[model samples]
Target: MNEALVLTWAFLLAFAVLAYVILDGFDLGIGILLPFARDDDDRDIMINSVAPVWDGNETWLILGGGGLFAVFPLAYAIIMPGIYLPALFMLMGLVFRGVAFEFRFKTIRARRYWDWGFIAGSALAAFMQGVILGTIISGIETDGRQFTGGAFSWFSGFSMLTGLSVVIGYALLGAGWLVLKTEGQLQSRMRTLALPALGGTLLAIAAVSAWTPFRHPEVAERWFAWPNIAFLSPVPLLVAGLAALVFYGLTSRRELMPFLASIGLFTLSFIGLGISFFPYVVPESVTIWESAAPSSSLWFMLAGAAVLLPLILAYTAYAYWIFRGKVTKETGYH
Candidate 1:
């Protein structure tokens, strides 16, 4: 029962994360793409495209963090301290991003600063998230399940590279979203951006994949072994196929399909990561089985999660449905 409860929590945690990356990711991408807008009018449209749904989109992040803390307190306690500085910066970026959304519309005089805030905040948040992921994948320093890493232990060449990679990936996602929401020259501009962003994302993926195996021997062994290799082969193959599909969609001027395909590529990459580090939640440290809270505690929380999660999903779907279709100069949060 404890095993089942832990698995359930892990599954929910993954779901929340994937939802955030797919939903909030494009908006963050939009923020990253903010500087490229031709003028204030274009910027307004871009901002308006996301304004209605952006705040709601972030609920998944809160859910994921809360769920992790509630269901796997030990893992949370260990991992948080190890990546404390990056995580702190990430939250600040998010706060800045949220504030920018509110303040950008207020006046012509202050718009420039808010715009910078949005872009820097989004980029920094994305980079820090990538750094956090890279740091964990590279291995967190732990002494008997307690984090022992110092202030800059999470910073490294590989983590920095991954940070840049995430920025590119977010840009691609943002471009895809713009293609769906805008038309004419704005869409055309996004099209031009999308192709290069796509290529950059693939390059980042390749670089990360190449170095990941060498940087961690256990990941190398897990992936390169015969049966595991055969089983996991489909992930990369599917990612390649999705990348090809995204390229074709962009060439064909199909808007939503490319974005969906981009999501698929990310999904496959995440799945590969999950497979590569199956038992461990903190990479060579605490396993899920080892780090989960007491069974009774988990069961108590399970009931609340069961009721609340579905309502969140339902409201999210309803919100999207209400906002469906192309955005225009006339479209806005009001």
Candidate 2:
């Protein structure tokens, strides 16, 4: 295998996943927050805030998943079976949420049911995604390149904790987004809501940080080993700084900074996770090089990605640009 090509594909795959998490995460956060809307008008404003760009945000998800299957089939094979149930549930939740997005606007009488679907679906998807993350962090059970874990291995106390953490974290994201995009009572309410959500998210991050190191000694060694710890201490420090910035922005009623800072929190968390698990695509078992496709296949896919990735990025940016600014009652996507 061409090491450079394989590493290139790994980096691309990671970038796609991160983009999906940051983009789709906010809209999913919006959906997770649907039930908290004060009334139908509030709900409309909240949903409308994301309506134009929500689906577009999911494109990165497709890119991430597709890239994994294409570029690292071996990792996909082992990891999918390990977390198949959660993955399936996540997809179903996303599908139902998408359906709710469309159908809620079309019916007045049935809107409440669709709204319920949206909330439930969003919560389910976010929680399942967290479960999958926990399962990955805790490490998969593989025997000779095959998943050797039981069907229920993905369901554990730690995974549930992670699931709940993601829910709270996403709610914080939703609250911050609403704070940024709405005005009047809705904005005020979201600003108020963001305070507690921010606290919960920070707590969740701390809990996950505390729990992750115990799951694998190597993870602890990676973070706490002499020179390594010296180098990585800044991640948690930055997290604290971002958390403080978010708190300040909320208290000061500054809209954009809170959202941007919340994003920074998530970005720092992602970087921390990357530090924990590098080179290993399947965590403890399969590495990027070990699981990567043949050089010829990678080169061919690289050509396609070279064209498609830029187009994806271009249209995604265009959609956001076109839909920029506050979504109001009079000028919503609907």
Candidate 3:
């Protein structure tokens, strides 16, 4: 495959992953915050906050994995085997969350069961994602195109910490989302939640930054390298500044800006991670070129994406436009 084609496919795959993380991240955050809700009313408000957008958001995750399988078959092959257990757990969580989402609003008798299911599923999915990410960042043990690592190797102390970080991060995003989508007491409650969530997220960022370098010397060297350091160092600084802005906005009760700032902070943090592992989709193990599928396969996948992606974007935009206001009891799905 030519370099131009390879880069194009890689860019598309990256975009899909970013979109999934940003879109689904907030809803997952909302789920994480479910246990903290004061009552059923609060829980309903939380569910309504994400109802119009949650299912649409998951499209990106589907696209991401599908695109990777089509365009980077080798990376898919390598990662699936290395993190198969966690991946299955994540998928199961997602399925449980989806089912709970619909059933929670259906019957009062099943409400409690579905509510807990949703929360558990969301936490499991988010933690499993973190474990997969940590395994990738920590490097997989492979031999001749096969992963030779233990089945449960992804679940370690560092990975668990990262998982908690993701939960906190998602909570902050959820709080910000609630701030934007709610009013009165609910908004106030979300604002209250945002502060601590933001603090926890920042601490997680710091811990991960400090820990990652020591865990992987090559990664540490890359961060401290001359030109790369100068170029990439601003990402974390920007994340810190945006995080501060989010806190300030929340504290001052600037409702809209707080959510926007939270999104900015999350985006910046994602950028930092992407930058840290620029060339490797599987962290230290496989380069994009090494893992990419044949040029023919990529072109075929691109043809489908050319049509499907625009349709997904159009529908998502339409849904948002249709539901663009504070949700109320009367506004919920039947």
lDDT of 2 by residue, 110-162 (tens): 99999999999999999999999999888899998999999999999999999
Candidate lDDT values, in order: 0.89, 0.91, 0.85
Give candidate 2 regions above 4 Å deviation: none
lDDT of 1: 0.89
Assess candidate 2 and give its TM-score to the true structure.
Answer: 0.98
TM-scores, one per candidate? 0.98, 0.98, 0.96
C-alpha lDDT (0 to 100) for residue 323 of candidate 1: 88
Q: Specify the highest-lDDT model's number.
A: 2
Full ranking by TM-score: 2, 1, 3
On residues 51-118, what C-alpha lDDT tens digit does candidate 1 reach at each position? 87899999999998898898778889988887899999999999999888888888689989999999
Stretches of model 1 off by over 4 angstroms after superposition = none
Which has the better TM-score: candidate 2, or candidate 3? Answer: 2
Error of 3 at 86 (Å): 1.1
Show where candidate 3 strays beyond 4 Å.
none
Tens digits of lDDT, candidate 3, 2-65: 7787888888878888778778888998999898888888899889878888999999988888
* Candidates sorted on lDDT, descending: 2, 1, 3
